[model samples]
Target: MNGPDPSRPCLTPESPPHSRGRSCPPSDQLGNSSSSSATTPATDLDSAVQDNIFAQAPSETSSRPLPIPAANALRHLPSPPLAREACDGGARPSPQRNCCDGRPAACNHRAVSDVCASLPEKSFARHFLTSSGTFPSAAEILKKAAFFNSGNRPHDALLLCNAGLEVYAEDADLWNCKGVTLRALGRLQEALDCCREALRLDPGNTNALNNIGVALKERGELLQAVEHYRASLVANPHQPTCRTNLAVALTDLGTKLKQEKKLQAALVCYTEALTADPTYAPCYYNLGVIHAETDDPHTALQMYREATRLNPSYVEAYNNMGAVCKNLGKLEDAISFYEKALACNANYQMSLSNMAVALTDLGTQQKASEGAK
Candidate 1:
């Protein structure tokens, strides 16, 4: 019998887009022998690669604007670049790219899934795929889904996450991502189901718990949302986002209680929220409203001023400040604040109405002074 012929893997012209800044050398080209002799430990090599990946990661604040009100505030806000690139179809690995020589078969699906499953839980790879040189694997799909979610393409993200779940149904992170996308799409019941499934798999999943809180909050289940937010905070106390969400839920509860003549209880809730996050602007604003409603204009003015100081572009705070000034008979100051509110958001109907009232009051005062003269 003739000896088996030597098999060689055919190299394809196309490869997956590079991840982060890592590039894979072409398989056909063997580099200089001297260059290949540098032996780095596997641990060091992995650390170096990760460091380079981190270096290539974009800064989050670089793309975020001041969140000003404008004709196209939402449109002008830069989408997360990582998320945008994931769904762009530019990062996909070529199907014909062989992983090993002499075997024409591409990388197995299980191998791809395993690589994704091994990623660090809180790493950027959990939400974004680096563009250096890594090929599209199952992890890349999950990252892409996350990118879609952050980029406000929740429907697309949901589809990609669902596809990933088909291959790795037991992935708690994937279920969490699916839940987030579902919630963003307003499919609250489905989102709840997905989040519950994620929590069932990983009882300590803070992300799932936080998302469940958001879904419940949106559904007007304020108490339930508060419970979930508290649970999430218990799991990860350092999550400021969850703290903020909890504060909002508490504020909502306080508002309802206040309307029901539970002023003391409402004050307690607002005080708790402020204790949780002293610098939270909305909490201060809500506190100011509570004080104003309870006939304490001085305290209300103090809270409104603090809110505006923390967030200068907070139009509602400016409007509230104007109301406090008007009550104090500081007509000129009230007008100034109302104008500032309108400057921040030209279409603010409340500011417009208040400005008209202030103008009328000023005119009446001027006319009365003229008659007395």
Candidate 2:
């Protein structure tokens, strides 16, 4: 399943989680196999529709992730603990890996030294991918969970994430990953809880902002969703995914306003959508529709062109463009645009009907010319 396409809206179901606890593809394997763990490329899945179908792919993970595997795999740490430590003093049980250096030998370095000297080995190694280590590292577990989340197995992903959170409760990325998995599972409230926890740990996390926004949008909380999306953009103005999401949300809001006859407010939303993401195709389409309704054929045609430029397969945009051209007395151009619409989506009835009309008009004009000659 591909990640969210910035060109579309949020939480669009990418791949159906028809099953859970499924094994991930070997391609998603993380960490090197030998002495050190290898890197597993994270898949940033879209919670919405499938990628190839081209509707709204999913909400953005990172502004960088336009779709699948959008941003750098959620904050990966080196597995197998980078360093081995033998605590001389501090606490009885060392929190560093498997080092069980009892409390700082009576609170003195000498006591700690005495204990280390008495140990059979000066250092210990915990292998992440091997049975030699009693347990997997938090990073490794999270990485595995990411793969599961990407592969349409939210159930397996949730299990791994919940397990990791228990051990690494303060990990922000871990919380973010868990949030994504929960969102994918349709556990909206639980997913929001995870994202809120992630935000508490890192208020500046754009990923969390986007994730929470997706959850909110899915729950019909448009204003809150807009708030999260707007916050994310403020945090990282350079993020394209966030910008795309904002545009999507605005477009939705605008559509609703248009239905309410709030034309001015709808215009503002459509315009703001473009401000958020200039290349957002739907925004252009909306603008075109508005301009056309206002009897501004030329401006409407321009907007439709912009939409088609951004999304070549935009059949509706093409159909609208034909209508605008026809209104402007460009019968040939109208026919061409209608044909383009049909080419993109052969079964589009609107384009087919428009094309027929355009052809009829062209035939009538030709007959008139012959009669005049």
Candidate 3:
């Protein structure tokens, strides 16, 4: 009872310790708190356990960088935030919705999967185009395709692009639009080819370049993705989304570098990412991780705080703050940060484990104090 109530209803591995139990003890109790009922004795072994829990940063698997999808230049939507990375030990949910379908939304809507279910793919474009003898202009067709693609009708969009291409073979926009639809449908190679064709027609096509970057990134070609993203930015520096995409690619590459223990090189990548998109929250979180790795807890805390400020629902950042605080011997602050993380995600196991460990340590320290008295 002096530490955590193991019998608490929601104290399972799947739930945070603070999800359903007594809140963390008051910070003022750090100097003196009742520990007579402490279950774990104060020993070097307890210290070792605490060290093991807080000293080692979470594994890369627990906090790998999330992939940022390339901006859909054809869709013409608002710039989306960079993808959120898992800072500590939880899977970050993707920020996409299944367009009224039951599949994972990351598939860019359920329609992308079943778009051809109702119609025959081979004749769909022919019927759609030939049926209207006086076909719309290439611009009109591209507009309609974009509308359909944005409306989650990627199959219809693809057909429109195909029919339009038959008439307007040299239209770069049509090819780019088709590439977007194909990518949405999981046809990465075809999508890449289409985007390449668009680029061939218009050598400076920003949309096609960005889409190609996306396809390449998906294909695990990070360096190529970065190159294309940079080219997209060079074509039109005003594109905020492209800037974000560049930052994301850099962060991803930096994460790989960090995993490889190339700390200085990784730092350069992260710094460049910040330069690319100053407001990107995940970049800040990644910076915090790097600073923490370099034994700079204060800087790490600031970076984590900035990340949480920019994105309040960042459970991983909060969990990491708690871990850093615990390592710095700020047990009260660590518990508070863990509580904040649990507030964001009640089922965050890392924060739960960390909170329990911090509470146990606090209890042991109090017991030691009383015995000394």
Candidate 4:
């Protein structure tokens, strides 16, 4: 697949740690500050202000693009695995040989004597020539199709896939690829059909299973999506994308349940996701949010801290950590967390707005306490 377009910059890059006026020691070069003693409110507030001015932006993954492959190369691939087997089953001789009239035989000479049998019989080579016109190989077609799909030309990809199927109709990988392209095109029903066909040909095809799961999820069939995701994981447990997708589906289900006040069930889903991938920062962040919403600020802060520790560049975790600190009346801690988030991502508007609010609160509390003196 082609990389992202060069002209379209999707993500913003983060700033260097030293840019925000914080001297992160060489030991903390990776920004793995999981724990630190709370600083004074004034010091934290000052750092937060500096962070707001110098924070970096989030970077996009796809920045450079590549050219698409040619369609001519795709029409010459080998026949489908099933078609090869059929040819090997003594169904017919090679297509390169001429028959009685110097034309390719539709059926072998042996079958011609039995008119009844011959009427229903067909030669593999004849079928192959009819489908692909004896041209480009299967691998070439798949490559071009993939190139088109990656370049956001799903319709062109689908057309190439269809043309390739004429020669290798029973190729499970081609079917799976077709399904993926169709899914990208938002033709969910067609994508499901393609995936099903692939699965029928190769029951353990993980790509087909994953594509089917995605289609089911898009159609709002959450439970069905779960089944497909589980099957996909069974087929290929090492696929992190599948695990992440399953977690997302579970999280969506949990969200619906939570709206119905099913907090315990939501927690279970979140817990399952964490168990599946402890290093997944989003899961930790979501868990922290849930805990915060449930009025357990201490648990929320701990989760947020864990998330930030795992991924020091997680701006959301830092922002949430600051919010929790503010709620707990730990104004200084909140300011420090907010400043760190701003340092990580300058365009983090929420951190900037909240930092301002926290400063105002700290100032008001300070003046009130001074007045009492």
Candidate 5:
């Protein structure tokens, strides 16, 4: 129980964001949290089974390096933080949310998936001198690398970051981007090292701090990850990614504590996560897990319902709701919930098994009643 939970999707790293093939100050720094404020559609995994949460990467798009702006434009912009990669990179729109509907997640509130941090267009123009020589188009490489990373081409981005470092060896943004790729590749130690290097070069780099937190979180060092997230938030208070990352880490910690039967501590962590980001439905799901474990079926059902409301495609929530309904002797309701679960994910084995059990139980009760009659 002190380790990871068997039935839950482990907390995935919600990476930082960059705009079209360019590093820029985080949108938070530019007072552009609105871009990230859009809701992200939720997907729930059953906590009864452990999945590779950390390895799942969100969708992103390709882009070319935009033109760097003037010095005034560069002054406040920080370097690029971690982002997704793309292949055969060229200009394209941001990653659209195809999960919920035909349109983008940003356009539809219900379809919102976890919207991570992003760089402001204005921030991408930030510039600094390179010791070797000024590569005016160097920032484009980083930007393209980000596009590649978000596009499910981490190896491409990693290679690009390496090539960039060969020329702009002092480029902390390159180092940070490298960390992002390593984390996506499940190279936790290497990713952390990259973040450290980036930090050494640009000690106050927000991207470096967030990337460090990501590596630690992926490594299952929940407390350390929490601290790093706190540091990232302190450095950039308005950063939605930082806040969301912290919430995830705390929820992970709570899950671990819950497994250990440390209910009170687990409750506290879950509460903290909710406080950090109320819109995060996973936190609610985790809370329901706690309540159900404690025999608070009514409250657990409420939480599960809330999770499904927030994320209509939350397969695990439906499965859990079915379980809770069965526990309460609501056999028909349990079957309904289980059917909903199967609707979301036909191959969800737990829901299949739960449905079978509920049906058998109902049959048994029916037989007994007939005999009594």
Candidate 6:
């Protein structure tokens, strides 16, 4: 009879319980040896298929992620995580390999610390190659590199990516991953080159397009950045993060237009930005500013309401709402809005000054009413 399939569980009744149902890779495929311990080196994956392809990539694990419809630039520069299940051909990552310690509240620092501390120098490339006589697959190397990226160890991540590229030169995801790690290290030109290479390999790669946008944005090429963001959206319309990035770019561009007194063009950009992501509160706030400038207080009030609805803690929106109300001769409403702004931020000088003026106006109006009565 033929021996058991290395890709399947042992059907023999005498197989040990621990070895049963494990779906271990062929000894030649993974390494020369198998260990019962869960603490195997990152390369010695028990089953490459066991990785959770749907798990969030390291870049998606920001402690303070941008709001769904972020109007400003990203809260933090994001690194694109590994490919999804569909993109990775269903290869999933182990939980530890995907976990990040970058966010203090989200990770077990000790586990990351142990992993980093125990890692042999050039572990994936040198040690594993020497011991197993085969390089780990691109997916495996990417997982370990992602783990290091999560721990804020970009140098290690870069090392892993470079090594993987030597063996899997045509892997687009590897190039994209390396690009993001290089971007993290502030190597913008090199990062852009890698992302461009990934784009060349996979023409419709949204991650490469998005990273290219990031690099351009960093270089202060807003218009070029906008083009890349638009290209990425065309490739994957469901990407909320990319949509937010687009909105941010548009908003920034609009501000520049407004400064140049191109009011109509600025308005068009703001409208388009809101169209891109209606939940972006700052865009609404910006719309309110434009309407207020154009002598449309009522419309401005509506826009301000939308802004406050999306972000209740938006002090600027509240303050501007107070200003709009005051201009409309609604002193009481203006004071209330000012008070809300102050509650959100007691040290906001604009609201403090506006609040005092509103209170003084209310007092003066009360005195005049008493005298008339």
Question: How does candidate 6 score on lDDT?
Answer: 0.54
Model 4 over residues 1-373: C-alpha lDDT tens digits?
A: 8653322111111112112212221110111111111111112222211110000010111011011111110000000000000000010112232222344313233322232222223632223323554344544455556555544466766766675665456666566667766666657698689878867866776656765775665566767976886887786676554565565555555544555668899788767756654654545655676777777889978877887776677666687687677767888898898899889878676567667777888899999999999
Per-residue lDDT tens digits of candidate 3, residues 197-291?
A: 87887677676777687667655576897898789778777655556666766766676677677878878987887798786666677777777
lDDT tens readout by residue for model 1, 212-292: 775665566778977987897787676654565566566556656765778899788878867765765655666776677
lDDT of 5 at 273: 75
The lowest-lDDT stretch of 10 consecutive residues in candidate 4 is: 74-83
Instruction: State each model's CA lDDT, in order.
Output: 0.51, 0.51, 0.55, 0.49, 0.51, 0.54
Instruction: Give a tens-digit lDDT track for model 2, residues 335-355.
Output: 888888778779766556667
User: After superposing candidate 4, which stretches have Cα over 4 Å from the reference?
Assistant: 1-134, 137-140, 344-349
What is candidate 4's TM-score against the reference?
A: 0.61
TM-score of each: 0.61, 0.66, 0.68, 0.61, 0.60, 0.68
How high a TM-score does candidate 1 get?
0.61
Best by lDDT: 3
lDDT by residue (tens digit), candidate 5, 236-317: 6765555656666676577567657688997998799778767556667667766776778899889878867866766666
Candidates 3 and 5, the one with greater lDDT: 3
Candidate 5 TM-score to native:
0.60
Clashes of each: 12, 22, 0, 13, 23, 4
lDDT of 6 by residue, 185-259 (tens): 767799789888877866766767866776675565768977997897787786665666666556556655765
Ranking according to TM-score, highest score first: 3, 6, 2, 4, 1, 5
CA RMSD, predictions in order: 24.1, 15.8, 16.7, 18.8, 17.7, 23.2
Structural RMSD, model 4: 18.8
